[model samples]
Target: MNPATRSAFPGFAWSLSRQKTLAECPRRYAYEYYFSHNGWLADASEETKRIYRLKKLTSLEMFFGSSLHNVIQNAISNYSKSRKIPRPDDLVRLVRSSLNAAYIDSTRHYGLWFDKPSRYTMFRDVYYGDGLPPDKIEEIRSRIGACAESFPKSKTFREISGGRNVRLMELERFRTLPFADVDVVVVMDIVYRDRDTGRWVVADWKTGKESAEDRTQLALYAMYLQKLYDIPSIRDITIRNEYLATGTWREYKLEPIDVDNTLYVLERSVMEMRRYMEDIDGNVPYELEAFPLTEYTRHCERCNFKELCGR
Candidate 1:
C-alpha cells in the first residue's frame, strides 16, 4: 500500500453512504476506502484484490434504484426543457431498456456472477420458477410509472418547471461542503429556492421503504445547505423526501437544535472512523483486524463480500 495515499489523515471525506457502510461493518469500510483505495496497481496485495472484486459487485435492487432514479431525473430534465411529461408507456420503455442494457453489461463486460438470475431475466423466469412473480414486476413498473406521471403535476415540480420563482439549484449535481475536519459531499435529487419566501428546499427521491436514517441524511443536507449558502438559520430550509414507490411525500422543517445534533453526530462518527485508521506501528496495515465483521449474520448473507469473509 502507498503510505502517502493511505496515510492521508484529516483529509477524509464523509458521505451518508460511506458513514453507513462504516457503521454497518467496519471491515467492509476498511476494505472499501482503505485497502482498495488503489486496487488497480499491479503490485496490489491479494487482500486488496479480493476487496476490489467485492467492491465492484452490485445487486438487482441497486440496479432498479439507479435506473428508476435516472428515469425520473431525465424526465424532469426533459420537462424543464420542453414542458411536457413523457407518457407512462414511454417511461416504462425507458426503464426496461435501461435495465436491459445494464443487465447485459453486468453479465458480459463486468462478468458479475449472480447466484440466481438477473432481475431482468427473472421477469420472464417467474413463469417457470419460484423467482420474482410477474405481478411484482408489474407492481414495480406501475410504481415508477405513477411517480413519473405524478411528478410533473406536483407543486414542487410546477415551481421548478417554471424556473422563474423557484429556481432549481444545480439540477442533479453533487456538491461538496468542506468542514474544518472533513469534507461532506451531498448529491441532492432536487434543490430549489422560493424567491418570495427566501426559503430553500432540498428534496430527495426515495424508491425504497423509509428509514430513520433518511431523517439523518436529510438533516445533514439541510445543514450543508445552510453552510454552503451562508443562510442565517436552519428554519430557512425545508428538507423533503419524495417516495416514488407510493407517491408519498415527507417534509421536515429542521430546528436549530436539529442541525447542532446532526453536526455532533457527524463529528463523532468521523472521529471514530479516524481512530480506526490510526496505526501506531507499520506492522498492522489498515488495522484490518480492528475492524471486525458484523455480528449480525443476516447482513452477511446479502453482503457482496460474503464469500471473501467465509461466512
Candidate 2:
C-alpha cells in the first residue's frame, strides 16, 4: 500500500487496550489491525471495505465514553490556558445534545457511512442492536448526568482548575515510547504535576464500572509517562482513576516493583501478539485461520464483526 493509503492508520502500534483486544478475541484483533489495512482505499476489495465498515462501529458505551472524555479533555485543556473552568451544567447540556445527535446519526447515517465509512459515525447499537431500547437510552443519559455533575465538582478536577502550578499536562494526544523494538502507543487522558505534592499524576477518567485490569493499564501508563518524560523516580509518579459515573476516585502509587512487573507484562503481551505475525519487521500478520475466533456467544452477540464471524 502507498503511504497515502495508509495515512489514517498508524501501521502497527502496541497499546495496553490493543493487547487486551488481542486477548479478548484474536480474530477481531486481526480484522482490526491486519486485514482491514488499506481497506479504506477507493479501489479496495469489497470484502475489505465491508470489514473496515464493521471495524468502524463504536458501541453505545464506548461512543458515550469517548464523547464525554473529549469534552472534558478540551475543558481541562482550555482551563490550562484560560484559567476559566467550565460549568458543570454546560458540560451536561453539551453531552445530552451530543447523545441525541449520535442516536439520530446511528439511526439515519447508514447511507452516508456506506459512501464514506471514515467520515461519518457507524454506531454498533444500530448495526448490532438495531438501536438501544428506551430504558437503555434513559440509563445512558442518567450516567452522563452523573459524570458531568461529578467532574467540575470532583476534588481532582477542582484542584486542576483551582489555580495550581500545572506542568506537563498531556491530554487527548497519542504519545509513543519505543519498547522491545516496537512503538508502544498511549493516549493518556491527563498527566500533570500536582505541584503542591511535588508528585507527577496520571489521571484516567472512567465512565463505567471499574475493571480488575485497570490497575495494570494505569501502571503501564505510569511507566510510559515516567520513561517518556524522564521522570527521576518511579515512586514519584501517582496513578489515579477518576470513576466519573459514580463520582469516585482511586489512586495507585507505583513502586519500583510495579514498574518492573508492568515492563514484564508488556514484554509478554508483545510476544503473544507477535505469534500471529508473518513478518515482525514489516508488522504483517498471518492468515485469518491463525487467529482463532472465540466460541463465546456473549462476546460475539454485541461485536461489530458478528456478521463476518457468522455469530
Compute each candidate's TM-score over C-alphas: 0.81, 0.93
lDDT of 2 by residue, 1-311 (tens): 67564543335688878887888799999888877777888887898899888898887788889889889987887877887778888888887777777777778877988878887777786777576767877888899889988998776787676677767564547877787687888778888887778888888899999998889888878878778778898888888899998999999898899878877988898899889888777777788889999866677877778889776
Stretches of model 2 off by over 4 angstroms after superposition: 1-10, 168-172
The digit string of per-residue lDDT tens for model 1 on 1-311 reads 66566643224678888888887887777777777655545565766665665665665566677777788788877876787856767777888787677556554543333222233232212222344446756666666677666665555676676656776677436777875566787777888889988999988888778988899999988888888788998898989887766677889899988877888888888777767765523322355688899887767655666666677
The regions of model 1 sitting more than 4 angstroms off are 1-11, 41-47, 108-139, 162-164, 279-285
Best model per lDDT? 2
Which 10 consecutive residues of model 2 have the lowest summed lDDT? 3-12
TM accuracy, model 1? 0.81
